[model samples]
Target: MRFDIITLFPEMFAPFLASGVTRRAYASDQVAVRLWNPRDYAQGNYRRVDDRPFGGGPGMVMLVEPLQACLDAIRADRAEDPATQVPLVLFSPIGKTLDHPAVEQWAQSPGAVLLCGRYEGIDQRFIDTHVDAQISLGDFVLSGGEIAALALLDAVTRLQPGVLNDAGSHQLDSFNPSLDGLLDCPHYTRPEVWQGQEVPPVLMSGHHAQIERWRRDQSLQITARHRPELLAKARAAGRLDRKDEAVLAKIADGL
Candidate 1:
């Protein structure tokens, strides 16, 4: 899959694309990434891309003209049929919050054009005309959409085959369906005893069933304590079986 990122600070992505475990995905072209700077397409002595908002805002708004020109160049380079043109995604406060499912979907897609807005925001006209989708990290705001874009790319890239050393690692990640959308259990490594605490006996028992049961119990407890809403969702979806309910019941009873 290919992602064309339109940003004013393309340099910010250079190190990110080259570093991390997900770099394997980029290096092997499994998740092809191309950065485009809208400033390059801006028409001015200073090549400005932002301007004062018409309604008199505190911050400047990204110009639609430069962004449109950049998108045009990208479309020509992609050379895809108009009917099959990839979605243009903008990171914004009003968009759907990104999550595991969204990342999974993007991982399997043909990829998209990611528009990273700067200053106050992009011109509303440009967003309405060109953007096909919008995604938000959360309720909070950022200086620019660059960080959000990086987050999305990293999440999607890591899900590509061979990106992680362990093929099944992500399957056990928090919010994955394999774990029934539960946060992962605590993990201990190396020393059986750390400081004064010893690794749980089940973990060292060489009994897979007992170990898995212990992990399930821990996962249920942690989720109930930290994110009870997820447990509620899992229960609503009928993903919590008898054994799972038993664990949750014990947690509720303070056992």
Candidate 2:
């Protein structure tokens, strides 16, 4: 899959694309990434990409002309059929909040054009005319969409086959379907004794069934305490069996 990122600060992504385990995806072309600067397509000596808003906003708005030009260049470079052109995605607070499901969708897709807005925001006209989708990280705001774009890229890249050292690693990740959308259980490593605490005896018992049962109990307890809504969803989806309910009941009873 390929992603063309439009940003004013293309320099910011250089280090990120090269670092982290996800870099394997980029290096192997499993998740191809290209950075494009709107400024490069801006006209005149100043090469301006932003301007004062017409409605008297406090901050400048990204110009539609430069962005349109950049998008045009990307379209031509990709040479994709108009009918099959990939979606253009903009990161904004008004969009759907990004989540595990969205990342999974993008991972299997042909990829997209990611617009990283700067200053106050992008010109509304351009967004309405060209963008195919919008995604948000959360309720909060950021200086630019660069961070959000990177977050999405990383999430999608890590899910590509062979990107991680262990093939089944991501399947056990929190929010994955294999875990029934539950948060992952706590993990302890190496030390038979750490400070004053010993590893849970079940973990060292060499009994797989008992160990899995212990982990499931821990996951249910942690999710109930930290994110009860997720536990409720799991129950509503009929993902919880009799044994799972028994564990949750014990937790609720403070046992």
TM-score of each predicted structure versus truth: 0.98, 0.98
- Lowest lDDT 10-mer window, candidate 2? 23-32
List where candidate 2 sits over 4 angstroms from the true fold.
none
Each model's lDDT comes to 0.93, 0.94
Taking every candidate in turn, the Cα RMSD to the unseen true structure, in Å, is 0.9, 1.0
Q: Tell me the deviation in Å of residue 20 in model 1.
A: 1.4
Q: Look at candidate 1 and tell me the lDDT of residue 94.
A: 96
**Cα RMSD of predicted structure 1:** 0.9
Compose the digit string of candidate 2's lDDT tens values, residues 1-255.
Answer: 999999999999999989989988898888999999999999999999999999795999999999999999999999999999999999999999998989999999999999999999999999999999999999999999999999999999999888899989999898888888899999988888989998888998999999999988888998999988999889999999999999999999994
